[model samples]
Target: MSTQVCIIGAGPSGLLLGQLLHDAGIDAIILERATLEHVLERVRAGVLEQGTVELLERAGVGERMHAEGLVHEGFAITREDEVHHIDLSSLTEGKTVMVYGQTEVTHDLVERRAQTGALSHYQVEAVDPQDFDTDHPHVTCRIGGENIRINCRFIAGCDGFHGASRRAVPESAIRTFEKIYPFGWLGILADVPPASDELIYASHSRGFALCSMRSHSRSRYYIQCNAGDSIEAWSDDQFWDELRRRLPAEMAEAVTTGPSFEKSIAPLRSFVAEPMRFGSLFLVGDAAHIVPPTGAKGLNLAASDVHYLFEGLRAHFLEREDTLLDAYSQRALARAWRAVRFSWWMTTMLHRFPDNAPFENRILETELAYTLESQAAKTALAENYVGLPY
Candidate 1:
């Protein structure tokens, strides 16, 4: 089939981009390797940055979120037997984050698209962007051993890190900036009740632990783990013990930890490509860059990047001014790098080093204390955590 824009991957970015284009009366095709059910249920991030929530509300996909998502006021940073809260609500003028998973966001966007009868091709494979001329780009995809081709005015590589999008760029034009941390986070979503109303970023001598609430009843938590540590190695007992270690003695009683529903370790890393666009194929989301999950910046940054891209496209189509369109990559990178910096900062502050380094632990402890006590430090964390300016 032919369309104005052909989007690879039906993740949040790809699907949202299609919806935005459709609203503008522009035609687009979304290709996904996974089934709709799989995409809708793949659990990931839950924190909704202020800008992301606004984008969803504007797109008319946030009614359920408005009713169901939990609004958080602020989060705590704990160290040295003390916990202090950073008032995110006060810092951001009541612009707080919502506890809604990326899975739910995908479901909402999918339902919205389905309401308009815009069908996306699901469970397809071998999506290749080729035959890029100045005027037209062709996306070749395989379905059930059949070679199907999609023609388009432009191709958007919203497919993530594992997809063909990033490597599709010519080697000469690719400038990859990357940093991989020594630690990974073992994230868990439990059926048991949440231990805290707001997130707690605890820098402990043992390691870092984060207790976050998805709802009043559902708990989502994580701890810094060895990159090679298997979830199989950590039983229910071990998880709770770790959670207790991170919690202060008095707060430990308040923390009613529970059984884990989901468990997986994600390595911490920050990476950004110098230029996010290469000819007709423009990359977005994990396809373009990955921020460590510390600052809760991953999903929100993707939403922000594509939001500007849509604005740029609107200007290109409606006003025929390439001002924003020409500046798309630069505009996106401006916001992308800010989140990158914040994520790196959070990662370094929260995660403990393995070396028998009394010095590093002391330094991290001091930093955490400053973050909790100093209004300026708390404000910086709150500002970045709430959302970055678009």
Candidate 2:
């Protein structure tokens, strides 16, 4: 098989890129190692930056999102028992974020891709991109018992951190930076009304806790835990009790406890692989970088990457230009590093460190205090929260 672009992974980044390419009358194929059902079943963050929203709208998949997703003009942060709200709309001149799950976004993209009759192969094995360094590039994989080879002008590696695309690169050619936090987030999804109108992030003596919602009736909550903590260690009742202890009294009382439908503990980490391009192969989304979920940049960063690559490819195919394509790595990394810094800052401010010196802990306290009290600081936080410009 021959195509203009071959995309690895059926996640949002791959699907969104394929959709944009298709709309431009470009031919591309997507390969996924997991089944369609598995891709849609994975749970992820739901905050959308304005850039992500506009990109989804451009792909013709924003109808459901605009209809069902919650619009958050602001969110709250608490230090101990004191609650402070950051008015995103006011601070950022009416910019706001949409609370839509990443799964739903993937589902919309997948459905749209299917409707377009595009080529997408799910449940493939041993997918590999070869000769990306040269003009001629191709991908080889196995479907069922049949071996397959696809020739393409370019390859997009969206298969995420552990996928074959990044692994395909020679270690000597790539440099990675990472910092693992001392704690993880123990989170749960439950069928109950949200404890507050907007998301609440709390920093307490016990730990950091976040009260968020999937919808008006479905709440998603998280509390910080030791890095080595197990999901099985905490029962539903215990999780709720612990969460309430971290939140301010008023917000805690508003929480409506119920049986949790999903539970997991995820370790926090910030990772970035520099220069997202390797000849004809471009690393998109998690393949290039990863941020702790504190600032909700995981999927947004992926969408921004799609935006840059899509523009580059569009210009290359439609106008016969390679400038954007050549600058893809530099442009994408510039925005990605800013997000990484924001996520790292937020994580440091809100979570308790196991071995921080007393002075360092006091500095964190002062940081939060100043951020809430100073208008300029709040505006900076709000602007970053709503998202930096594309």
Candidate 3:
């Protein structure tokens, strides 16, 4: 097989990139290690930055999102029993976030790709990108006991952190920085009305909790837990009880709980790999960086990375320009680091450290108190939460 670009994942990043390139009359093929069902089964964050929403619109997949997604102009933060609201729209001059699940986004993109007859090979095994540093790059994989090779001008490594794309790069050539938190988020999805109109982030002596929603009738909630906590350890009643204890009195009373449909614990971490491009191979999304999710930056950061790479590829193929392609890594990294900082700051201020000293705990409390009390601080928080400019 021959194509202009070979994408090594079927996740949102790769799908979005392929859609943008396809719309621009560029040829790209996507390869996935898992089946389509498995891809949509993985639940993830839903907060959408303005830039991401625009990108989806550009890809012709925004109709469902604009129709069904919730627009959040403000969210609340609770310190013990006191609730403080941050008005994102007012603070950012009408900027707002969209609450659309990642699963829905993927489904829309997948359906559009199928309608357009875009090539995506799923349930592939041992996918590898070869000769990415050279002028001629190719991807090799085994699909259904058949060996296939795709020759392309460029290889997009959107296969994520654990995928083969990042591992293909030599250790000496790339630098990585990571911080693994001592806690995890035990999240549940239930069919019930949300506790509030907008998301509520709570910080208490016990830990941190987040009250979020997928739609008007579907609620998603999370509470900080031990790093080794398992889903089997938490029953539906037990989960609701712990969650209610962390919320403010009013929100606790308003929260409607039922049997959870999905439950899991996700470990928190902040990781970034420098210079997202390696020769003809360009890393995007989780393949290049990861955020702790406190500021809802993980998926947004991936969208930004896609924006940068898509522009570069469009320029290279449409305008016959190489400048954007040459600068892809630097441009993506600049925006990525800002989000990383924001996520880290939010996590530090909101989460209780397992062995934090008295002074450290006091400092975190002061930080949160000041952020809630000062208008300038709230504005800064709102702006970042809504998202930074692309």
lDDT (Cα, tens digit) per residue for candidate 2, span 1-390: 999999999999999999999999999999999998999999999999999999999999999999999999999999889999999999999999999999899999999998999989999999989999998899999998699999999999999999999999889889999998999999999999999989999999999999999899999999999998898999999999999999888888999999999999988999999779998999999999999999999999999999999999999999999999999999999999999999999999989999999999999999999999999999999988889987
Clashes of 2: 0
Q: Roughly what TM-score does model 2 have, to 2 decimal places?
A: 0.99
> How accurate locally is residue 278 in candidate 2, as Cα lDDT from 0 to 100?
94
Model 3 agreement with the true structure over 1-390: per-residue lDDT tens digits: 899999999999999999999999999999999999999887999999998999999999999999999999999999999999999999999999999999999999999999999999999999989999999899999988899998999999989889999999999999999999999999999999999999999999989999999999999999999999899999999999999999989899999989999999999999999889999999999999999989999889999999999999999999999998999999999999999999999999999999999999999999999999999999999989999998
Q: List the residue pairs that clash in candidate 1.
A: none
Q: Assess every candidate by TM-score.
A: 0.96, 0.99, 0.99
lDDT agreement with native, every candidate: 0.84, 0.95, 0.95
Model 1 alpha-carbon miss at residue 334, Å = 1.2
Global Cα RMSD, each model: 1.6, 0.6, 0.6
**Which window of 10 residues has the lowest lDDT sum in candidate 1?**
128-137
Per-residue lDDT of model 1, residues 1-390, tens digit only: 788788888999998888888888778889999988899878888999988998887767989998989899988877737787788999777878898888889999999999987769999988888866366689898977789988887788889988888877887888888998988898888876776777888877788888887677878888889988998999978888877877898766677767777889998889998688776778888887899998999999999878988887777777888787667788888899999999998888878777738887788767777776788888888889998789
Alpha carbon deviation, residue 387, candidate 1 (Å): 1.1
- Whichever of 1 and 3 has more lDDT, that candidate is 3
